[model samples]
Target: MSEKEEKHVIPYINRELSWVDFNYRVLEESFRKENPIMERMRFLGITASNLDEFFMVRVAGVEDQVDSHYFMRDLSGYTPAELLLTLSQKIHSFIEKQYSCFTRSVLPALKKSGIRFLKADELNESQKKYISEYFDKILFPVLTPLAVDRSRPFPLLANRSLNIAVRLKGEDESYFAVVQVPGILTRFLNIPSEGGNDYILLENVIIYKLGELFELNEIRSACTFRITRSSDLDIDEDSDDLLIEVQKFLKKRKRGKPVRLELSRGHDYETELFLKEMLEIEDHQIYEIPGPLDLTFCSSFASMPKYEQFCYRPLQPVYPPSDFADCDDIFKAIRERDRMVHHPYESFETVIDFVRTAAEDENVLAIKQTLYRVSGHSPIVAALIRAAENGKQVTVLVELKARFDEENNIMWAKKLEEAGCHVIYGLVGLKTHCKILLVVRRDEDGIRRYVHMATGNYNDSTAKVYTDIGIFTCREPYGG
Candidate 1:
């Protein structure tokens, strides 16, 4: 309240708002005419994915604070409620900009480049016949229409699952039902085209054949909708077993309170109200997307082989990098001098080979590493298991709390434990974020230690895209 105190408090951008701004900066890449069309679409998808996480974790946390009546102002000097309101406005405007770029710029460019998305009405008789048969053979059998009535409560929809809200005319009165568009199938269906590749959204195909599912009643209206649920875990550090607690939390995460609801543009008013009431969300939380419910699908669509010419040329990293070109032995290369590997430019295989060598080397005594996030079929994890199986001591500190990667890490932890490796589930209330690998070997001189440190996770999948620096050293202080 004092003038001096107020002056000392430097005004800073709110973290939530700053993150949204960062995503907007990413979105700006899509608007650039110089960038390849496919790359621009990929950038747009990245923004949508970023916004989804922002709502699930950041917005959900602030809403929690507001609900608890915690009015304390952040360093940015806005109360929880005020920040939430500002975020709602900022996010709505950001989404509008996202769709504007998609519709005005990306769609036209894609069409010009020989890729097109045809609507239901645009299809010819042959296409319609093909779609109808395809729907019956492929979609009809898999689709389950869940009717919402007093007897049957609204289905507990999973977070982010796209569903169709169908309004049907009953014998007496009208009611609503839900038909989940299966995520298992592809989002875009490639049908026969006269010239270039033409595709139809699976949702549109489903909407066109809704009468098949509801033969008893007349279909009135149907629209695609998706919900983002709160996924930020509330950890109890005092739990008896952190792994089991995290497992329980993971289940809760799937059905956590709905924080965001996305509906197709021009959604029915009655249906929208029904959804809002069921999800317990406000008007600001509801986003009426002008195009698709989720633009994340655009990333995969951009990777089509037919659109390869419109995409940026892929870069291949140099194998057996110059740093280790002189020596065949990885240990000798590190022992001679500290070597650095720049990722996505120099291959990540150098790092994997380092671990594989440690696992296979006769003189190597122990291998230790920290795993934060890894690929589904991680070569690094396989090498660690090999090290343990080779009778060398292997200690792996698997960070189970890694966001969206808990399940994968858990599976790897169990595999490592079964393979006789010592697995640590990280420290309580703190994430093990550092990327480190230490190999102890009994050299002729004495016991020598080699270390591999990096700025990114040991995930090979990400290494192809992320720019990271990794260093291999056998000298003191660093290896210490």
Candidate 2:
């Protein structure tokens, strides 16, 4: 490469490594003492959630390239295989730091704050008795132990699902089996204790009563493991129907190629070898965690009641915000001036009211919106449905390829269609990510159009956490 060419070689961090670094910044919050303990725990959970997607999409894509023998380097100058190798090393080290923060820092802080997790061996006699009864009544019936033998083969575990790989011993030979920790149940079980908010991990409870699950054989050892699979949808843009194509891919996503495996630390060699072989994963893909398999569980635990002192003071969205404070009518507010609503600080309710009012308004002739992602039981979708039901011309572009939100989007699309709304599944080769809403109405003067444009989704649930800005405008140029 000549000097001129060398200058053109832009020096940039590998995107995969850069993403790991980004997640590390989130993990750094858990290490900070200044932040509230539960808030710090939430940040840790956020990092875990972020890494899960990184592995599923980014890491999985690289593996596909390596499998196809694509040796071309990225802008950062690392080939597919090289990038994967470097990413594995970077992620492994990052994982070590993550567990260190969780076990050494977060757990101790949580204990100080009246939250404590007891191990199986640390349980008192009464607690053990309670656990036994709970297992028999609540767990046993729901749990199905899948045997792993020559005849049976290892089960196809669901992506991100937690399972316990159990080693059992019979009179003549040893056997291996798997019991998936029920996802429907809570990850942490609160138990009766004298001191603090005492709880034990659901997996520990199952591990304690492994013998009951495998009554015919003696239980040797059991360890919890979780797998992150490649979940990126391979959309056939040329397919007959994009909705049906996406639905097909969503089914295939359940059993997509495994990208990362998380196992509990200090497992037997036999169990480790068995898993690696069965999952067809390299050593780099396996992560032996020192603490819990999935820390995302902590995110929900952070919201436990009566622990407000250990969490940040909740910021309530200022209702009837300055933009809409003087005027109750959404249309009048927009007609007066271009109003910008800063979310979380200001309310998302202003935008919701806009659609809702349009639905109810007798003069409103039509409404249009693009939904990329929305909350479960979205109010925006409900308002759109209401608008359509009221005989207003309503057209909604619900992007079905919103990554991890396909199923929810699909469900909302169906509801919108059923409610007599013209629902578009989005463009064939592109995802409609813009957040815009348009309402057409007849004013005292003539026909007019009002629009609400935003930097975020119409998800009211996320409005509390995500800082997004939206503008309400009735400008002639914008309307046209």
Candidate 3:
């Protein structure tokens, strides 16, 4: 290839940047005053959550290439380091907009609606009393404060967990320590009162009481921060046991390399430098968030039943088509022909019914299914367990490499195995993300097969929100 020809620009938008743009569009919805307040907050939360995963997986990959000295530009024509620098600039701007939308647009609207966010400066005597008591009773015992000095090393921080960085004045020198905000506790705390309702950030409450945690030293300064780590799971299919390999991957993922750091403005400068050097993160990777570190707490607001008036009208999952509406025999309906249901508008019951029907049917011989993710109770999993317990051969490919869902998949896989079903992790070097379910059954004619396939996981809960298409069929091409 000629040098001139090799330097030609590709006529395609970089996918990572494209994805960031998509998330920004979602963030824009929060700026709309006409939209229901809580619903808009959910949009803000979704934006933040999307960015977290974007850094963990997408940005992390680019950084890995740069680290390995692999500078080959993609079709989009940006080298790894160049792309990272561009993405970091875009992200910094995007996050500034998010906080601007929250503080200026959303916060004002929320205040008008009787939801007030009183900061530490605005806390009244009663509010301070409540916060102090709450901290002592709830947060204090769970809080593990790690101080970094010559003798003590910096503690490993979890991916995306919020922490408070504190600078304390020792006898002769100032040092830094971190207090991890308990993830189990709610980030937003409501102060009870009849005059009006108010809430405060959990991190602010801790920052207010840092002296309690570090009584020996004078409190210099403190601010909230969070870090995102690379969370990709590599599957070794060549390994004798794929499930065991996934378990090992899950442990390593928690301690994955730091890809992005979100620090709130106003932390002590020296301590900030201390963290940057200790964590070994580049300048572009550090994000100085203007307001709150995490907006996912806003998404939780959408679930409050009390805020129904401030949210959109609830949408229930619609029933299946008229033909299969009252059908008692799901197997018979599938045997006759193919049936497809559009989820979120229609229902996910058809898929669940197929599995449940097969589980109970004495004529059923075997059930084989690929599970990517499912509901909490997971009727699909329960049905598979029932089938296995009833002496029906059951084979399940549970993809433990499903990002952020490895632990849940691992738990379900063990249950399925204990229930006497054959649970396989999936193909080595590749994640089996395909959603397919097959049930072998005995019919009057001979051995027949039933199949359920979908564009999404068989999670009944998400079916109401995530638009998906699922089909149940007994056709030879699909089921055979």
Candidate 4:
């Protein structure tokens, strides 16, 4: 390598630090004064979600290099350990700024908009009584307290699960126990208020009721904490039944070693020591969050239905092409000329209806598609099932390793297989991220093929929100 290249004098920024800056850009959206308060809150939620994935995949990779003793410096001229230290500093600063934006700008504005998030101490007597009762009646049954000691080892905490580590004083010596906030329960709980928005944090609720959980011991201190574990899937592309292997690894991902620990500040001494020793994490791995352990609850908060006025004006999908609207038969329109549809700007119904029409068309011979990430109740999957049952040859490529969508895709794959569709797990060592659909019809021209292609997934639901381009064509060059 040239000396210039060896010295990394190209003046490029660190990839990891650049990614952290990208997340900060998302956080900056929350600071814009003109944007609606709810939208800003959603932006904050997006940044949090983005950071979670960053730690799971990106940060995990750097940590692996450090663990495996791969000391080679990157093109940016930093060792893995040095890069991690730099990333840690950047992440801490970015997160601090994130919370500052939320608490300073977003929270006060949300209050004016009649949305209120109450802490335990901030609750009125009636509100406190109500919350306490709600906790005893509803949350108590789902709670399990794990005590850490010699015979009874610490429980394996689930990745990203909010938990409260309690320091207790007993007859022998002070010890620590942790209780995970139930995943099934919503993090934000709606409480009765004087006609405006009122809610409580689930962690706060859990904290208030900790005394009941450990009635036998003295409650010295209790604080919320969460951990991010490496969730990157290691797929052996050469393995048989890639679906089964991916499924196997998906289970392992939940138990992957902890990569980042986000502990709510003001942890008791014993609690902090226990987390350090039990998780076997480094000091730099511990992120002392001054605010909430997780900000993902903002997503559900922003989605509250009653106040559309407090959010961005909903943008409706534009009408499909004039040719499709002007022509009675979509197939005839595609065959006559190529067509393009822009989504969020253009309705996805045209695409859905095209498939639906083919399912019912007796002249159609076959249907083929690739599904990566699909909606819960996907109309495309339904139509494919209909086509298969009607004796039309249906071939569907369902990529089972679509990251977080693995379980959902697996379900859809099984359904397609049961419906008699020729379902495949997609090309080995490659994710079928491309969006394509092919249909063959026994027209008067013998066998004619029509294709629908896009730069995005064929998800009708997301089409209303995300911008994408799609085309419908029967061009011989494309079909061939």
Q: Would you list the rank order by TM-score, best first? A: 1, 2, 4, 3
Best by lDDT: 1
Q: Number of clashes in every candidate structure? A: 0, 0, 1, 0
- For model 1, residues 1-480, the per-residue Cα lDDT tens digits are 899888878568899999999999999999998999999999998998988988889999999999899989988889999999999999999999999999999989888877788889989888898899999999999999999988988999998899999988877877999999999999999888877488899999999999889988888889999999999978787898999988999999988999999999998988998889878889989999999789999899888787788888988998877787867888887888999999899999999999998999999999999999999999999999999999999999999999989999999999999999999998987999999999999887778889999998999999999999999998553234
List clashing residue pairs in candidate 3.
237-428
Query: If scored against the real structure, what TM-score would every candidate get?
Result: 0.97, 0.96, 0.94, 0.95
Measured with C-alpha atoms, the lDDT of residue 328 in candidate 1 is 87
lDDT of 1 at 433: 93
lDDT of 4 by residue, 204-252 (tens): 9988888889988899999898999999878788988888888899899
| CA-only RMSD, every prediction | 2.3, 2.1, 2.8, 2.4
**lDDT at 361 for candidate 4?**
99
Clashes (candidate 3): 1
| Per-residue lDDT of model 3, residues 1-480, tens digit only | 888987774798999999999998998899998899998999999999999899989999899899999989888889998998999999999998999999999999998888988888898888899999999999899999999889999999989999988888888888888899998988888975555568998988998888899898888888888889998766576888877887898889889999988889766678778889988988888889889888989999667787889998867666665547777788888877788788787867767777888899999999999999887899999999999999999999998778888889889999999999998886767777788998888887778788888898878888888988877888553234
Q: Rank all candidate structures by their lDDT, best first, as comma-separated numbers.
A: 1, 2, 4, 3
Task: List runs of model 2 lying over 4 Å from the truth.
Answer: 1-9, 170-173, 477-480
Each prediction's Cα lDDT score?
Answer: 0.91, 0.90, 0.87, 0.88
Task: Report the C-alpha lDDT of model 2 over 344-450, residue by residue, as the tens digit.
Answer: 99988888888889999999999999999899989999999998999999999999999999999999999999999999998988988899998888887778889
Over all chains combined, what TM-score does candidate 2 have? 0.96
